[model samples]
Structures are given as structure tokens and as C-alpha cells.
Target: MMTIMRKSPINVRAAAKEASHERIVQAAARAIRRSGYDGTGVADIMKDAGLTHGAFYAHFESREAMLAEAVDRAGAESNGFGARVIAAVPAEQAFQALIQAYLSKEHLAGIETGCPVAALGSEMPRQAPEVRRAATRRIKEMIDLVARQSPDWGQPGVHERALVTVATMVGTLMLARAVDDAALSDSLCSAALKRLAPSDA
Candidate 1:
């Protein structure tokens, strides 16, 4: 005899709601990355998430609220990837490995799945206060992650160095993406990587 597994009605509804919420956030994350925060529309995100526009309020209180969550989600995703990259290499070489991976051409081309700081940094200043605060918090988290891998991890100036390193990486990637010339783009990334980690060059 074959047995069937049946979910309770409440369980089914709860699961469906969770799934829908995930879709909305994921869609918003992608949309905001492709388009700046101001450019992303609730209707477009809902449509991409396979939901109608009217259902947005059921998942989020407002557009700004959804964007704040999305920004946090994007930062978490990037930070998680960075952690994995660092963890995959030996501790002594982890920093250089991360620099290489971050400055690679692949990362330069992958805007949708790339670093949110590089993609949205410029637009962040104009965003709502809550959204800007969320981005700022994530930026600090990223800087802290880099600081932990530095030689002067516990030193006072280590965080400042990490801040500079993160800024250089994000700035280089942004400039590389802005230019139309392929060679120039690659050169910009290479120059930044070399300056930041000469031994890795």
C-alpha cells in the first residue's frame, strides 16, 4: 500500500506565505541590483516574483521597508560569499585570494550577483534614511570582515586600512564597469589589485 503525506490547511497556508515572501525579497534584491534603489518599482518586483501588485502590502509594509530588507539581504549574500572565498584559502594567503577574486573580470561582469556596494554606492546617498542606514551597516560589516583577515587585525589602525582597501576595491570595480573599453576596464582592476596586494600580482 502507498501512503500519502497530507499537510494541515494551516501548515499549507504558512508554507505558501513563506515561499511567497522569499520570492518577493529575492526579486527585490535582483531588481535593486540591476536598477538603483530609486529606479526599482514595487510592481516590477511583484511581477517578477510572480505576484500581483496589490499583494505587495501583504508581504511588506511599504516600498522603503521592502528595500531596507532587500539591501540587508544583498549585503548578507555578498558577505557570505566573501567569507567562503577567504575560508577556501590558507589563512596566510586569504587576503590576497579575496583581493584577486573580487577584482576579477568575472566579478566585474556580474552586476546582478556582484557586490552591492559597488553597484549601489553612488545612489545610496540619495536613498531614504532607513535604506541608507542599512547600506552603511553592511559596509561596516564588510570592512570588519576584511579587517579580521589583516596582519594587524587587533591593532587600532587596522580598521582604517580595511576601510581603504574596501573603498579601493569598490571604486575600482565601479570605474571598470563605467568604461566601454574592455582593455581599460581590465587594466583598472589589475592596477587596483596590484596596488592593494603587490605580492599577489
Candidate 2:
């Protein structure tokens, strides 16, 4: 009698499911960051992930579900950026380091690898409810990171300052990206950074 050769269907199913799901989430995050929430469609995200649109529902209950997961992953990936910014300087130099990093020419030109808030914040409020909530939480976490680095600031006022700092950084980048004049863009970022720098720094 010849022995039967076979593959384990359960193991194969598990591996395929994990790979496909991760692919979909990664593709969605990239597309949403580049295109904003409304601009990226499920089909396009699936196509970019090398999976069929029909496979989307197997991983996500809806586009909103995918967006929520994508936002969370983006947040986690970006979680260390602010901490890294502050860690690279003396206490007196922390704010300036952050300012320079946020406003630099490299940041203005590199959206895909930089701040997700700068890339996605304007459209965030308009996103699906789940996406909006995820974005809001990520923004809070970023603010908290900046606040944690500054011991000189009052506890109550730290959050407000963080928000203003983030807004200025994001807005400066947005304006810089919009204009045909490269000089104007650089000037706006430089001015904002100068204003936000700690008085002693």
C-alpha cells in the first residue's frame, strides 16, 4: 500500500490569513498617509497589497475598521519620533532641536516618512468616526511625549503648549508644500521655528 502525502489545511489557512491581513493593513496605512482618508479606496489598497478586493472583508469588517487599525499602526510607528527628537539634545536645547527637526527642508519634502499628523490631520475630522477617534488618540499621545520631555513647563499648561507647537509645525509644513516658491516655504518654516524656540535657547 502506498502512503498518502498531504499538507495540513489548518496550518496553510492560518499562514495565509496572517499574511493577507498584515499586507492589507500596511497598504492601507501607506495609501491613507499619502492620499488622506477619503482619497484611498478599499480596492486600491487591496491592489497595492497584492490581494484582491474581495479578500478585504475577510480581514476587515469595513473600510472604517481598516482605517482604525491603520491609524493605530501609524501611531505606534510614530510613537518614538517625538521622544527621539527630545533625546538628541540638552534640556535647554530640546525645544530648538524639536523645532529644527519639524521645520527642516527634509521634513517639508518628505511626507511619507515623516509626521502622520502633518500628512493626515486636516482631513482627520472628516474621516469615519472610528478613524477620527484613532487620530485624536494619536495626537494626544504625541502631545504627551513632548510634554514628558519638558520638566520646566507647568503641568496644566504643557498640553496646551504641545498642541500649539504641533499645529504650528504641521501648518508650516502644509503651507510649504502648497506654494510654487521654494524660498517662501523655507521662510515660513524658519520663522515659525524661531518664534517657537525656548526663550533661553
Candidate 3:
């Protein structure tokens, strides 16, 4: 016979608060992606998270503060996905694997969970300083990861090349998503993949 243990009131309240905060941040992250930063609202986020709007202040001081955390969360998730792709492939194939995964149709249709760099790059300049800084840091981390897999790794220009490569990929994806024609979207991604990672083509 085992006795069941119950959480103390203090522990229960703390746990509930922590869970609510996580829900808010996660909802914000998804909402911001579905509707750009300027479009996502605190009330909408709270509603999506299944919480009352009045309870928002208990977790975040302001909407801007929530947006910053949302941006950071999205960026971290993007970085984590890239890291997993790189890790699963051989060192020599890591770059190609990353490019393929990034430009795939699956990623194109899944914007809500896709790369924040491509989704939010154009809007970064218009966001709060904290949001921009958080995104910039994550973008740099992504570039560095690509640079490590470059043929010119350790060479002086590898970092610059990595920047160009990442920029091209992000730009291509953005353009692809903006177009109305399905063929055009496929063409954009195909062209970028062939041009940037020809060896993998």
C-alpha cells in the first residue's frame, strides 16, 4: 500500500503560475509567426493560451516584454532544429542537409514553426531593441554553425561566405512564400538550392 503525496498550497500555486507563463510565451511565439509581430496582441495571445487577459500582467510587465520573450523562444527553436539536422548528418554532408531541410516544401508550408530569420527578418528593424537584439544573436549563431561546415572553414573569408549563403537562403524562402503561384514558389526554392548547394543537386 503506497500513500499519495499532495502538493502544498505554495507549491501548487507556484506550479500553476509557471505553467501559465509557459503557455503564454508558447502561444505568443505561435501567434507572432502566424500574424507578424505588430499584428499579435496580448489579448489574442492570452485567449489562444486559454487564459484571461487580466492575468497577463502577472506573467509579463508589458506586451513588449512578452514579444521579446516570444522572439527569443522562436529563435532558439529554429537554432535547435538546425543543430539537430547538422548533427544527424556526416560533417561533409551537414551543409547540404541543412540547405535541403531549410528550403523544403515542408518548411515552406509550416511557417508557424519554421525559421524565424526568414519569417521575421524584414520586420526586425521595426521591432523593439530587445526583440531585434534577441533575433540578431540567434541569426549570428546560425551563421557561425554554417561557417563551421564550410569548405573554407578556418579561412579568412569563410565567415563572410556563410553570411552570404544564409542571406540568400532566407531571402529565397521569403520570396517563395510571398508569391501567389505554386510553380513560382517551387522554382524559387529549387533555383536557390541548385545554385547554393550544387554538389547536393
Candidate 4:
């Protein structure tokens, strides 16, 4: 006779908890992305996830906690965007690849799937402290990556230059999304990229 091995109940419970938490986070991210931070509510997010509001406290302390998680998710999603471009091109060409990809017609039209910085930048300053902190960290991380691609920038004032670059990218993308004229959208992206382009490039 052979004896069968059984899985630990603790491991199963942990996996279930992780899956539930991830589902809630994803649902919150979608809700917040479609509706700005102030416009969305805990109930709405819970409803979207098909979970009860009572269940929320099991994973987070309050709405602010969930918002922080959502912001972190959005930030990660936004920053990871440049990875594909950076991988395909040399570091010298990385910035150009980013500019082109970000300014492209497809990106301009795809608001739901586009960069969160471009989608939600105007709303960041108004978010709760925790959410704002997450946004700040993500923004800094992205800037550091861009500065790394630009060797001449040095390390001292990367923050300022990164702000300019990020601002240009977000502002132009927002303007492109707001307008009805295709030509105007294209021009806005082109002009912004030119302004933010590195001096050496």
C-alpha cells in the first residue's frame, strides 16, 4: 500500500488570500483609471470586483490604503512601458525610442491603455498623501531611468531635467487626447518631443 501526500492548509489559504488581494487591487486600478481619484469610491471598486465592502478591510486598512496600492500599480504599469523600447534599442537611442513610441498616433488614441502619467498627471497633485507619495516614487524612478540613458546629464540635476522631459511627454499626450483634430495631435506630440529632446541628440 502507498500513502498519499497532502498539501498544507496554510499554503492554500495564503495563495487564496494573495489572489483575492490582487483581484481587488486590479479592480481598484481600473476604476481609478477610468474615473479620477476623487470621482471613484470604495463601494464602486468593491462592486466592480464583485466583492463586499466588508471584505476590503481584510486586505487594507481604509480607502486610502487601497488608493495607495492602486497608485503603485498604475505607476508600475506606466514605467514598465519603456522597457520594451529600451530593450529593442541601444541606450543612446533609448530616449528617442521612448519619444517616438509615446508620441505615436496609436498611443494618442489609446487613452485606456496609454501611460498613466499622461492619463492622470493633472490629478496627481490632488490625490491623497499616500497616493501622491506613490506617484512621486514612480515618477522619480522613471526619471532616473531616462537620465541613465542620457550619459551627459550627470547626476546632480537629473531631477529637474527629468521633470521637464516627463512634463513635456504628459502634457503633449493629454493635449493630443483632448483635441479632435488629428493633425493638431500629431503637431503637439512633435513639438513637445523637440522641446524635450536631449542637446546632444
Q: TM-scores for all candidates?
A: 0.93, 0.84, 0.93, 0.86
What tens-digit string does per-residue lDDT give for candidate 4 at 1-201? 998988799999989889889988888776677777787798888888878878889889989889889878877876787778788987788877887788888888766556767777889887789988987898788777777766466778776777778777878888998899988988898888777774357
**C-alpha local distance difference test of each model:** 0.90, 0.80, 0.89, 0.80
Residue 195 CA displacement from its true place in model 4, Å: 3.5
Better of 1 and 3 by lDDT: 1
- Per-residue alpha-carbon lDDT of candidate 3 for residues 48-67, written as tens digits (9 for 90 to 100): 89999999999988888999
Tens-place lDDT per residue, model 2, 65-167, is: 9999988777766666656878878876776777788788887877666677878878876778998888788888877776665555776788788878778
Model 3 bad stretches (over 4 Å): 1-6
* Ten residues in sequence with the least summed lDDT for candidate 4: 192-201
The 10-residue segment of model 3 with minimum total lDDT is 192-201
Clashes of 4: 0
lDDT of 1 by residue, 171-194 (tens): 999999999999999999988988
User: What shift in Å separates residue 159 of candidate 1 from its native position after superposition?
Assistant: 0.8
- Sort every candidate by lDDT, greatest first: 1, 3, 2, 4
lDDT of 1 at 62: 85
Residue 12 CA displacement from its true place in model 2, Å? 5.1
Q: Backbone clashes in each candidate structure, one number apiece?
A: 0, 0, 0, 0
